[model samples]
Target: MPDTSQKAGGRRNAQSRREDQPMYPATLKVAVIHWVMLCAVASTVAQTVDLSGEWRFKKGDDASWRQPDLVDTDWQPISTGSPWEQQGHPDYDGFAWYRRRFTVPTALRDAEAFALTQSLLLSLGRVDDVDETWFNGQRVGGHGTFPPNYAGDWQAHRSYVVPNALVRWGEANVLAVRVYDGSGMGGLLGRRPLLRAATWREVVRLEWEPGLGDGLFTAPRPIAFQATLHNDSPRALSGDLHWSVEDDEGKELSRSTVAVALPAGRATPAVHSFQPSSPGFYKFVATLEPVDGTKLLFSKFTGYLPESIEAPLTREPDFDAFWKETLATLAAVDPQFAVERKIDRDSATHEVYEIAMRSLGGVRVRGWYEKPKTGNRSPVLLRVPGYGQNMRPTGSDAPIAFFSFNVRGHGNSQQDVSGLPADYWIRGLDDKRGYYYQGAYADCVRAVDFLAGRSELDPQRIGVTGGSQGGGLSLATAALDPRISLCAPNIPFLCDWVKYFKASHWPEMDKWIEARPERTWETTLKTMSYFDTLNMADRIRCPVLFSLGVQDPVCPPSTVFSVYNRLGGRKEFRAYPNDAHRVNGAHRAVLNAWIGREFSRPAK
Candidate 1:
């Protein structure tokens, strides 16, 4: 059984209360009390000035533009928080200038004159590449050196402090920024710029790291709860750090309260350790708040989960029958294979062929077929693509026949179906027979059928491989077709739909579910059971190789293990500790070696 307790502190929002999890609100109750306490010490004195309006933009470099009195009446008007590509400069590179004028608040000027405020911090969000900012006529701050030795901090969030002398009290201030983008999209591509008190923002950072060695946490492992209290305000923060650990189901397992004082303009680190009694998912949440103040310094969440977890199958009653009938329907159609030789994609070692074949519902699917020029019979490797991706020619130099298959609703096959994911994934969900993946899975089986019919390919040594949606199709193809002898799936999707619907990290699924309240969970699960890879796991008889990431939010690691645990074939599994949907390069090397070794062996 897949333990929800294991994912307690996993991906997404930790404080989320699921239908299956317990409803005891230890954190919620504490939050209410904290809110009341924060209401007692109210003091709002800091001021914030918004500088996000239209700015005068001029392309190319000019040192004279940075001057406070420079005129830019002919410059184009552009808004912040949008990339230059979206602002009619799609291919623009090199230096560009953005100039904006804003009036300083009278109150802020008065406070500065009386020396009541610390300093003014200009928050410029994130600038793609490098930038130099000038307030009035003086240089306030800059990130990265310009020109020949340009070292661009492309993803840096810029925060520059303006010197007290630079402020022309209550007057209009000219803020000129010179930005250089090295490649692709650039310019102000993040949050809008703003001017605020240096001591207004306070932050609390939380990180949960394992106290022991990496990889799967088998049982009774120690986890460290690290919290850093940051006091950006000029004042100190004296508060109690209320931290707790809850099972995946939101039941409080442990709690702690530490009274500490945070100094002004500094970060203080606090460390706590807890050993889980057994193996499961748990969440560690920390909230730092002053005893009698309205400022809730921090209430952040992080998880402490096992490396591996398993989920139950959401199997339909006719799971086998549905696929059996679907494949039978595909077999009924004559796969009129249209093979066109592509000279451009061909090499001296391999001959490339663009193949189009008829699949279920008469949809024409496409694939790039590459076979060794000198070989009459070679092992066939069928590669599928990730979600919505078109199948392209393989870059592999392996001595094998490679067929990159693009199922219906993808690549050239989209002539009859939409390529948009939201349109396809939920299409025909009203009936299991008309579900989109039924045709997609049939298309995969048809790809295998095409390989089996080719005389130059070894039908007995055909294998399937892909990542994400491709990974799910790989498993489904091997399960539906007996011609496939080996299969490797990486971070596969469309598995454990029941579990996925409960806590889906993907926005599309949530939006789909939220858009239709009448469908309910029961109806959705029934329709998904037909496409769930977990239900098809038991059907795959070939040697299986699976890889999944521990921190994968799109396809939960627990649901992936459900498919792995249910497989009744020779199989191997690998888990990447700090990966999301994609695995690392080292694992890719191992996967290639494994597939090569599998193809080299005799057909079972």
Candidate 2:
């Protein structure tokens, strides 16, 4: 129940840093930085300056703003590392500019001192969407393709070399940044931007791969920890790389060091194998110290368990009885089905209909339905969406019927109450019967009923698919209703609630717990047991195709793997290394192929 959707802000000032504050001093803030850096090699430069505080900020972009002499009399002050939305410009999107002035340290202002460093480089951490950066009066760097056909690399850290000839040895230098955020959180997000020496760099890249390649490791089975070091400079580099494996609670399980050497433009990877004696998730971290005192670090999260997950099914004995009663109450209500055709959204291959249905508690749920114009009945694809997202037709011209359904309090179904996601997930937490998702889950079942009643659809071939919250809903629907024959839930939420509260970085659920500190963890978890997807995994008998990212912080791999291990039906899973919440094209291809095979199979 943690709030995982918080906007990306200053890395050192973000959740990770706050969590480490109790252990490290302000001067040793770099200790926390060591844990967050994944593959970036730390530069050898010993002397560097951090650029993380207030800067002149403006909402819109201007060409002249990049000029060094431009005065920002009206521009407001904002942090360089936090998103603008999280600050004061919550509603503002599109282009924005950030400007700041800093003079070379008076001690390093000498030309000889500058010559020793050769050329200076600027590290801009990571920017959301797209960005163009300027130093003094010249354009220095740009990341992500810009405008017209814009695609921002939200995860990349920007590091650019500043030309030596343009160095203002003794005078003040100005840095300007232009940014564009398409959706959600925007602006410069990541570690503090800094000025560093562009000398020899040492980077440590680490990955923990299970022998099964499934992102889940069995106890007593050896897991490979692969580490690679890259030398960015055009010279040979050598250093001592130290690595350690730690439990989820931060206890070091194993530690060792390796001497690594890399020629120019070369990478040296070393594999270290370790066998876990216990079950749980562990963090593998590698640290490399270049010539500088600063430590470069990289880490990967891995889980180890028995062939069977030890996660207990923490459901109440009344769980089935409670759901059966709710369904009975829902069945008594008559769903008045109505459809509105969206001609503009329709194509020659398929017709789009905006359909509405009456669900539990008499709430109206809405969905966009698409079916092949062919008269023959086709398999149906019921898609539930991620948290707070409105459902829209997928518009795939494949030979199948599709329904993008929105549950109560979502999209057009928000008649009874607005589904502000932050509030929706934990609504009515104290009581099981009044929980919000009870209605949401009922809406999904009603959607299946609606599909069963349709003459143009095959009830036997009904399938459910979704990601994140939708993925959890897919499992719930398939477990509760036997009508669902196929299920594909990607990076599902709502699994292992008690364990999730401790393993994830999300803090939303913590807010409710903080407000009611009087409520014991046991009581809170008991209420959550009725809704935990881990409790529902065993009830699903349909064939399932599940996918997840190993580095997903929102839905940790341990929790997802627990659900995977508990499935009582035929199931296949795909896992990606170093990926977060989203899946790549190859994973999508696998999912599409799986769905195609299921749809083309002979009906029972």
Candidate 3:
């Protein structure tokens, strides 16, 4: 497949955000972020009232139920997140009424103590079908339509602005929701309902220079951004604005503070200019603490010269020898291969089987295999699974055969070991030989051997692919076994172990390390180096196609590049800038095409 690139990114004010990159005509070729953030603000003004949990519910709707004075003591208590069908209504749909009573604390209604505006947004998440919402006997807003020429969308989320007068501020208030579902699930069906104050997103339109890209740039050129406030309120607002640009490591490179006033009913623009000294990812943050309005926060992540990113190499001197000896030692055991053809799963177009084989420690492992029924010998794709996931038989209609292999400690291979514990990453941290991945990697190689043993499978055309942990296994399998001809890894984990811990964090990962006195990060990472894909990247010579989520906190793109940049083979990658750990369907389409195109070539 030809290398592909296009526009993609996600954004929200001050929340874990993605930035839009602007196209720059300057010869410097840097992507202008058009975003900046405020830092070290004295205060931010906002309030959130959680309205989730149990609420009074009834099977049928009554117009009087919307009244605040109605006594609903006999109504059933039902949770707001799930549909009424799941809360015991069964297939019964049509109309239902939900009522909840809450007290708005005086703290949230104060409009004069430093913060002037206390606008309320009642977020009911996404409700199936249509709903008419009421607060304290007053119809605030609603969504879709009901009956007579019925038209409503299940995908439409419910957010309604509440007028200050109806809130019964600092007093008890009653909320009611009248919903109608023509079929299937009904009632509030997504996130819990809540009321939150409007943030910077409501008052500002942040514009970056050259509006073509989002969160990607070139190095050595100054980054430019400006924040504009809409100031649509009744009076002019004055507040302190704090802004800064920081590197990926959270180190502040530039920062400044200033007091600014925004004129009412107009747009006010505040622009800033700065340049990053080197290539990599940088973040811009801005905060607006309006003296009498809601506090707004902003952050945008941008990348510069990402291709030049380099990670610290921690490969042990005996890394190659360590793996060579282990493989040699494990090969001494008989594989004890077994295959059971599942007649029940077979079709005219494909043959299905449950297969097993022995790997390190003579431990037996299992996987699901499905081969095309054609007599022609075809290339095989060894499919792998992500961390702690169970994989079913891949019935992909693609030209090649698919073997969904599971390493020990996963799926049906739990006979020898099980990934039952959540803290698998930290298990066996003391010994390199005992680490969970040591045996898992060997299990992948053993699967390759099993694939090669099949007379109908083209060993020279075998390709390995998966996401997350499976992605790491794909690279490791190719690195350890010369039989693998093509490798495709997406958002791969288990690379650049030291950096992985720094870029992302998990409560389980931290608790495990903190629980033991002898476990130092230095010693743990030293052992991890043996299985590090970055250390093994140079050994693989097959064509490699990598896809990454640039915003992935689990398997940082920088760490993925450390392995990609070091590969001693033909390699190309497609990046999704806004993704966290998983690449979406966009990458999957490219991967399928890339696999089909690469496998068509003669064996190297």
For each candidate, what is the lDDT?
A: 0.70, 0.73, 0.72
lDDT of 2 by residue, 1-604 (tens): 1011112111112323221111111222344477446324443234566677878889887899999999986899888666787688865768998898887664543433234335567889878768999999898788876677776566667887665666686678899988887654678875578875564332223334443665556546677766556554444656777878886556789999988776754667777777777776778887776634446677877766633556888989999999999899889989998989998878567799999879988888899888788878988989886666566665566678888888877667787757654366678878888888888888999999999999999989999987788888999999889999999988888788977877764445666678875766687789888888899999999999988877777677778878888997889988766566764324555777888888778877
How do the candidates rank by lDDT, highest first? Answer: 2, 3, 1
Model 1 TM:
0.61
Global Cα lDDT for candidate 3: 0.72
**TM-scores for the candidates:** 0.61, 0.69, 0.67
Give the lDDT of residue 317 in candidate 1. 74
- How far is each candidate from the true structure, as Cα RMSD in Å? 11.3, 10.7, 11.2
lDDT of 3 by residue, 531-556 (tens): 89988888898999998866666677
Write candidate 1's Cα lDDT for 1-604 as tens digits: 1111111111111122211111111333355588967743421344567889799998899888899899888899998887776788865778999998988776875553124335677889777668998898778778766878776554456887664567776888899999986654568754568876454332223334432323355544476656566554455668788777765445688888989887865778888667776544455667667523443543322334433455666776787777778878888999999999999877556789999989899998899888888766988888886676666665345677788788887777787776754256777776898888888888998898889989988888998988888789999998888889999888888787866655444454456677876775578778988888888889899999888766665676667776777888799888766555664434555776788788878775
Model 3: residues >4 Å from true position, as ranges?
1-214, 225-240, 258-272, 291-293, 343-349, 506-517
